[model samples]
Structure formats: structure tokens, C-alpha cells
Target: MGIKNRLKIMSFLQYFIWGSWLVTLGSYMINTLGFTGIEVGMVYSTKGIAAVIMPSLIGIVADKWIPANRLYIILHLICAGALYYAASVSDPTIMFWVLLVNAMAFMPTIALSNTISYTCLEKNNFDTVTSFPPIRVFGTIGFILAMWAISLFRFELSNMQLYIAAGASLVLALYSLTMPLVPTAKKKKNQNWVSMLGLDAFVLFKKPQMALFFVFAMLLGAVLQITNTFGNPFLHDFASNPAYTDSFVVKYPSILLSVSQIAEVAFILAIPFFLKKFGIKKVMLISMLAWTLRFGLFAFGDPSPFGFVLLMLSMIVYGCAFDFFNISGSIYIEKEVSSDIRASAQGLFMTMVNGVGAYVGSIASGKVVDYFTVDGMKDWQTIWLLFAAYAMLLGILFFFTFRYKHEPEKLANVGVKH
Candidate 1:
């Protein structure tokens, strides 16, 4: 098979493992295992905890010792075991520890997969800028298909989802050995621990603009986890109401939520144009507004006819809310930082968004949900509205605080170096 097809299969299985369980796990924990909101939050927060340092730490090991593809295989193999163990646990605390181990092994693979893909593409003389996106989009399709499969097979509320993910992980682990070997970075003499560990990326925080950008990135990162942690559960909550008990939205919330991923593919195509025309600041601002709409629509939406429209719109706006900030932010970081520390800088960005942001959001949103609960029933509308208010506040503050002038020449020159 050609390298692109090989990479596409790799990408597809990469997210398929995650999509099999991520959105529906909360509902499963809530409905089947009877875990509390805080418990579920902590469960999801395990990903954040692992993201906090695992990626950079594991990255150092990959760069200095193991080849990327070898490390990728090892990590997935470990993830397969961890996930299998996670399936047998019912206690929240034990599950947290199990999932944390799973996250440590799994999160690093996300970056490693990119490294492997980029290296393979460059070796084959393909322009990564144009070629990689198409391959990456397959990952999203894989995620969508996994979600549909789990829902259709009624695995969403069972341990079977984890089994499916583990099977995929095991398969990927073995398949990864067939990938083109990515040589480890050569060790330089007299290299200190700081540089070897990629901690030099931390120096970017010395700049006021970069520091502030990361701070807000953390805040938005929090927003990202909130929906992921509870969106399906919120949809499933409607099943308790007689009016919505038989609604299609309740029966296949994952498929409905899959609409967000579909919208993401479309919006990702529009990013280059938006970045060139409006610059990163404005583009991110649009993402913030879209996030506001995303949550606001969910606030009033239900499984009813008119309300389902709102739900679908929320999923559509999620495309902008997610792709714009994440992709644009990465591009912006690439523009501002030196190429030498580019990989480390990207790691730091993931740390801020997925690590600190997700941790804070998961914990805090859990408390917020619990606070809004009365007589064991959650007030989801209020929860969503509060989230919307938070996004709106972030947007307003970002507008006045972030002050980068749009420079078309700089953006136009991007990717030319690569």
C-alpha cells in the first residue's frame, strides 16, 4: 500500500479508540454504575491529569531514546491493557487510577502519530501542509463511525465500549510495527536535562503576549472539556421525561453529537481563508462567539421538534468553536516561535488546553452540576446557560486584551519554510 493509505489507516484507528467511549462514558457511569457528577468529572479529569505532563515527558523519551514508531506501539499495547483493566472496575477512585494510566500511555500517542505521519510524508516528498489534512480528516470519520457503532450496538452504556477500544488499540499496536521506522533524534554532547526534556519551551512564557495567550488557552480548554464530559449525559437525561423518552435524540445522542465532528471537517477547510483574511485574534474571537452559541443553544434545546433544531445548530456551531481556536492557535504559535522549539511549543499549547484547562473545567463543572442538582435531578438548562455566560465573558475580555495586528505577509509566508 502507498504511504498515504497506510497513514490513513493509522489515523482512523487512532481516534476510533477514543471515539468508542469518550462522549458516552459519562452517561454510562451515571446511569449504569450510578456514579455522581463529581465522580464522572474526576473520571474525565484523569485525561487532563495525564495530559499535564505525560506528553512532554514521553516526548523526551521518544526523542532521545526510542524511535517514534516503536514508542507508539509500546504505548498502545500498554493502553490496551489499561483499558481492559478499566472495564472491570466499578469504583470511581480505582477507575480514576486506571484511566490515568491509560491516559498517560494514550495521550502521548496523539503527538507521536503526528510525528510519524509528518516524517513519513516528508520522506516521500509530499507537502505536509496540503497532504496531511486529508489524511487527518479520516481520523474524524473514524471517530464518528465508532460513535455510531457503539450506539447502534447498545455498547454506549456498557463495558463493551472499552473492550472495543482495547481491541482497536491491540490491533493498532501490532499494525504500527509495519509503519516506516522513525529514527530517534541523535543525542548531542553536553546537552543539559532542561533542553533534552524540551522544557526550553517554557521560556516562551516570558513574553507577555504568549503568556496571556496561553492563559486564555487554558480557560477555553476548560470550556472544551465541559461539553465532552456531560453533553451525552445531558441528552440522555431527556429520556427521563415522558415527552422525550422516545425521541430520536435520546436513542442516538452519539450520532447526533457526531454532527459536531461532521461540522468540524467543513470548518477546518475554511480555516486557511479565515486566518489569511482576519488573522488569529479575530478568528479565535469568532471561535469564542461560536462557543457561546454552542452552549446557549444547548441551554434551551430538548428532544422536542423545535428544540431538536437548537441541538443540531449547537452541534453545527461546535465546528467553528472547536476548529477555529485549536487549529488557528497552533498556527499562530508556529508563526511566533522559532522552529527549533516548535514541537515543544506545540506540546506546551496542548498542556495548557487539554491539561490545565481540562482539569479545572472538569472539577469545577462537576461542582457546578452538583450545585444545581436538587432531589437528585440536575438542572441542565441552567448549567448550559452558565457555561454560555462563561464563554461570552471570555470573548469580551479577549477582544479588549489581545492586541496583535494582522500581518498578511507573515501568515502568507507560513509553511514555506517547511
Candidate 2:
């Protein structure tokens, strides 16, 4: 009925569309479609590929021509069609193109959703710093719900997940038409090609501290994609072992994976205190260490007893590994970059983490998995340990290279402002 509620719905469906397919799509491809590791990685890498180009181009179109909300609706309509087609594809090549189209239509909407929400909230005189986080929390809830629905309904390895995502995309498309309109920005006479394309954000690289932060952001981005691409399949692979065949972890991997999302929500709430107490640099180091634990725990974890505890620990630490870098990094970038290129700078950050970084992570992770597979059986423990070693190496490098003194006063007022 109100603006906040409308924004909440938008946030919910925005992530729900992604959650329906993202976490379990690898499992579906691996178990049902019989796609190889490389094939599955190629499919998922479409998001990264699309993210590199589409979001900035779409942002320009939204700024100069279409209103954000209207463009948002249009993208969802196209995404709905793409997802429907993706559900019917049998060939990996065809599926790659289909998902790439879907990613192109869907990836830009994430930024558009935030733009729409910020505009509507400010227009209604709501303090976004205080109001937006609570509304955005619903997005994570929506993601978890989608995962639960797919798992509980036994659709985790079925094309039905894509259909569900397509249906939700269509619903969101229609619902978005009723949202508050966001006007496009008027064209400026002196704008250059770089500024128009949001490439002006690249200027942040001129600063040493900002440059280091983004480099590590890209590295961590790669780390993030590794789990998303393999975690479900890894769990499902446990069925090969007799002792774990009937275990709850194997039976309901998505529900178990949803623990990571739940942990994400809890960690997000604690970010403000962590920021005020530790500042960005230490918070980032903590995230790096958490990432090490996240992968290391998985290296020895199983579906039962003590090993299950390790698995649970991995899920819980995922929150810290993810939020401490991503959410906090965004906040840090906001503080570091100039406001004039702020939007573009944010776009650059996403491009690094979600675009190029994700692409590299997916492809490399696929190669690693394939390398560890002998006689069609994957050595998951070795694979996970290698990842853990990578994370630990990154932590050591970051500790020595990144230098930022704590400034609690600067962030004392920074409590989930995004």
C-alpha cells in the first residue's frame, strides 16, 4: 500500500528470480542434464559476461532515455522470456546463449531496483540510510524462500526451477508497472564518452589505497563464485557414499545451503558495530580469514556427526566471508570516491567483482574440478583444500599489502546506510 512496502516487494522478487536458479542450477545441470564441469561453469559464467557489459550500457539508457522503473519492467519481461526458453534447451551451447540473454536482462535490474528504491524513498522523505536496509533484508528472505521451495518440492535438479523463476519474473514485470515512476536524468552538454558510459569510475584506480581495495575485491569475487557454482553439486555428490546416502544433508542440500543465507542476514545486522569498532581494513582482513575457514571447513566436512558440524561451520562462516567484503567494501568505496562519479564508481566495483572476477573464477574453478576428477569421480576434499589454500594465501598477501588506519569517528554514524 505504501512506498516502503512496494520497494520491499521489488527487492523480494529481484532476488527471488535469481535464487530460483542460481544456487542449484549447477546441480540440475550436473545430475539431470549430465553437463560436464566446464559446461556448467560456462553456463554460470554468462552472468559474469553479461555483468561486464550490460549494466553500464543499461544504466546509460535508463539515464538518458527510459525511466528506471519502466526500464526495470521491460527487463523483467525479457528475462521471463529468456528463462522460459532456457528451461527448454537441451544443448549446452544453446543453453549458454539462452542464459546469457537471461543474464543480460536480469543483471541490470539489480542496479535499477536500487535506483528506483532510492528515488522513491527520497521523494517520500524517508531516510534511506535508516529505511532501506530493512527493506533490502526482504531480498535475502526471498532468495532463501525460493531455495526452500525448489528443495521442498523436489525441483532442485529439475527444469521446474527455471519455470518458477520465469513465472516470478513475469509477475514482477506486471507488478513493477504499478510502482512509483523514476524519471531519467537530462543529458548534459559537456559529457564525454567515458562519463556517459560510466567509465569515469575507472579514475579511482589512480589512488593507491582504492586500487588495492578493488584488486582484492576482484580476488574475493572469484572466491564467492566458486561456492555458488559447486556447493550444491558437491552436496549432491555425497549420494555416491553409502553412509551419507540417506543423510539429511544430502536429502535437503538447498535447505542446508539456506543456512548460509540466514547467516548472511545475521552478519549484515552486525556490520555496523564491526565497522565502527574495527574500520574497513581490519573488517576486510577478518573477511579474508573467514573465507579461509569457509573453504577449509568444507575440505573435511561430511553429512554426519563431527563432519556435519564442520559443514555447518562452513555455512555460518560464509556470512562473514561474503558480507564483510561485499557490503562493507561498497560502504568503503562510497567513503573513498568522489560523489560526482559515485554511481559510475559503484558500477566499476560491481564490474570487477561480478563481471570479470566472476568470469575468471567460474572458468578456473571448472578447470580445477575437472583436473581433480579421475575415472569420472571427483576428489572433492582435495579440490576444497586447494581453494582453502588459495584463500589463506590471499589473506597473507592482503595483510601485508593493504594499509588503512582505523577511523571509528568517520564510521560511527555508518550503520547499514546502504
Candidate 3:
């Protein structure tokens, strides 16, 4: 098989493992095992904690000791074992630790996969900028397929989802050995701990604009985690109402949620044009408002015919809410930061969003959900409205606080740098 084809397959399975379980696990924990909102949120927070701690440490290991492909293989092997064990865990605390192991093992592989792809692509004389996006799109396709597979097989509320993810992780572990090796970086003398840990990017905090941008990034990151950790469970809640039990929305919630992923793929393509036309400030403001609409629609949506339309609109707007900030934020960082700290700055961006933000969102949202529950019945409408208000407030604050003068002509150079 061609290298690009091979990379595409790698990308597919990498996300397939995640998609099989990520969206449905909350429902499984909540509906099947009768776990509390706080417990489930705690479980989800493991990913955020792992995201903060693991990626940089693993990156150092891959840079100094092991080949990237070899490390990728090892991490997936661990992920397989961790996920397999997770299937048998019933205690919320035990499950938290088990999933944390899986998260730690799994999160770093995302970056490692990209590193391996870039290295292999360059070695094969392909332009990464042109070639990698198409290959990466396969990952999103794989994610959607996995979600459909779990939902169709009726495994979304079962431990079988974990088994499926474990199976895929194992397969990827073995398959990774076939990929070309990626060399470790040459050891450099006198590398300080700050640089070694990628903490040097903290210098960006001295500048108010960057400091504010990062603050908003972290806040939006929280928004993303809130939806991810709760969206599936919220959809699954409709099953309790006999009036909606037979509806497609209740019967195939994951598949419906997959529409959000579909929108993501479509919206990603629209970003470069949007960034150039609207400028980053306006584009990001649009994203913030889109998030408000996303949650507001969910607050009003249901399995009824008209409500179903609202649900679909929420799924569609998720693309705008997610990509406009995430991809655009990365582009803004790349354009603004120095080349020397560019990679580190990117790492810091993810740390703020995925790491700290996810952790805070998970725990706090859990408390909010529990607060809205009485006699084990949740006030989902109120909960969603509260979240919508939060997003809207962020949009207002961001519009006033983050001041960036956008240069459309300069954005043309942003893509070229890659």
C-alpha cells in the first residue's frame, strides 16, 4: 500500500477506538451502572488530567529515547489493556483510575500520530500541508463510523463499547509496527527544565492580548468538554419518555450526534475563507455566539418533529462553534508567536484548552447537573439554558476584551508557513 494510504488507515483506526466509546460512555455509566452525575463527571475529568500531564512527558520520551512509531505502538498496547480492564470496572473511583490510565496512554498518541505522519510524508517527499489534511479527514470519517457502529449494534449503553474500543486499540498497536520509524531528536546540551517541559511558552502571558486570547481559549475549551461529556447522556434521557421512546432521535442518538462530526468536517473547509474575510476577532466572536445558539437549541429541542429540527440545527452549528475557534486559534498562534517558541506555544494552547479547561468544565458541570436533579429526574432544560447563558456571556466579554487587528493579506501567508 502507498504511504498515504497507510497513514490514512492509521488515522482511521486511531480515532475509531476513541469514537467507539467516547460519546456513549456517559450513557453507559449513567443508565447501565446507575452512576451519579458527579461520578460520571469525575470519570470524564480523567481525560483532562491526562491531557495536562501526559503529552509533554511522552513527547520528551519520544524525542530523547524512543522512535515515535515504536512509542506509538507501546502506548496503544497500554491503551488496549487499560480499556479492556475498564469494561470490568463497576466502582466509580476504580473506573476513574482505569480510564485515567487509558487517557494518559491514549492522549499522547494523537500528537505522536501526527509526528509519525509528518515524518513519513516528508521522507516520502510529499507536501505535508497539501497531503496531511486529506489523510486526517479519514480520522473524522472513522469517528463517525465508530459512533454509528456502536449505536446500530445497540452497544452504546453497554460495556461492549469498551471492548470494541479495546479491540481497535490492540489492532492499531500491531499495525503500527509496519509504519516507518521516526528518529529521536539529537540530545542538546544545557537544555533548561522550562524548555524541556515546553513551559517556555509561558512567556506569552506577559503580553495582554495573548494572555486574554488564551484565557478565552481555556473558557471555550470548557464549553467543548461540557457538551462532549453530557450530550450523549442528554439525548439518551429521552428514552425514558414513552412518547419519544420510539423516535429516531432517542433510538439512534449517537448517529444523530454524529451529525455534529459531519458538520465539523464541512466547517473545517470553510475556515480559511472565513478567517480571511472576517478576521480572527470577528470569526472567534461568531464561534462564541454559535456556541450560545448550540446550547440554546438543545434547551428547546426534543424528539418531537419540530423539536427535532432544533436538535439538527444544534448539531449543524456545533461545527461553527468548534472549528472557528479551535482551528482559527491555532492559526492565530502560529501567525503571532516566534518561530522558536511556535511549537511550544501550540502545546501550551492545547494544555489550557484540553487540560485545565476540560478538568474545570467536567467537575463544575457535574455539580450543576446534580444541583438540577430531584428524585433522580434532571432539569435538563434549565441546565442547558444555564450553559447557553455562559457561552453568551463569554462572547460578550471576548468581544470587549480580546483586541486583535486582523490583516487579511497576512492571512494568505499563514497557510504558506505550514
Q: Lowest lDDT 10-mer window, candidate 2?
A: 409-418
Could you arrange the candidates by TM-score from highest to lowest?
Answer: 1, 2, 3
Tell me the lDDT of candidate 3.
0.84
Stretches off by above 4 angstroms in model 1 are: 30-38, 122-127, 183-193, 334-336, 405-418
Q: State which candidate has the highest lDDT.
A: 1
Tell me each candidate's TM-score: 0.90, 0.89, 0.85
**What's the CA error at residue 341 for candidate 2, in Å?**
3.8
Best of the candidates, TM-score: 1
Stretch of 10 with least lDDT, candidate 1: 409-418
Q: Which of candidates 2 and 3 reaches a greater lDDT?
A: 3
Q: Candidate 2 — what's its lDDT?
A: 0.83
Clashes of each: 0, 0, 0
Candidate with the larger TM-score of 2 and 3: 2
For lDDT, candidate 1 versus 2, the one ahead is 1
Better of 1 and 3 by TM-score: 1
Mind giving the per-residue lDDT tens digits that candidate 3 earns over 1-418? 9999999999999999999998889889999999997798789878899878876567656666687889899999999999999999999999999999999999888767766776677678675434665677778788999999988899978999999999999999999989988886665689898666545568789999999998999999899989987898799899889999899998777789899988878777677678778888999999999999999999999999899999999999998898888767866776676544533465567777888888888878888999999998999999999999999999999988888887777765533343
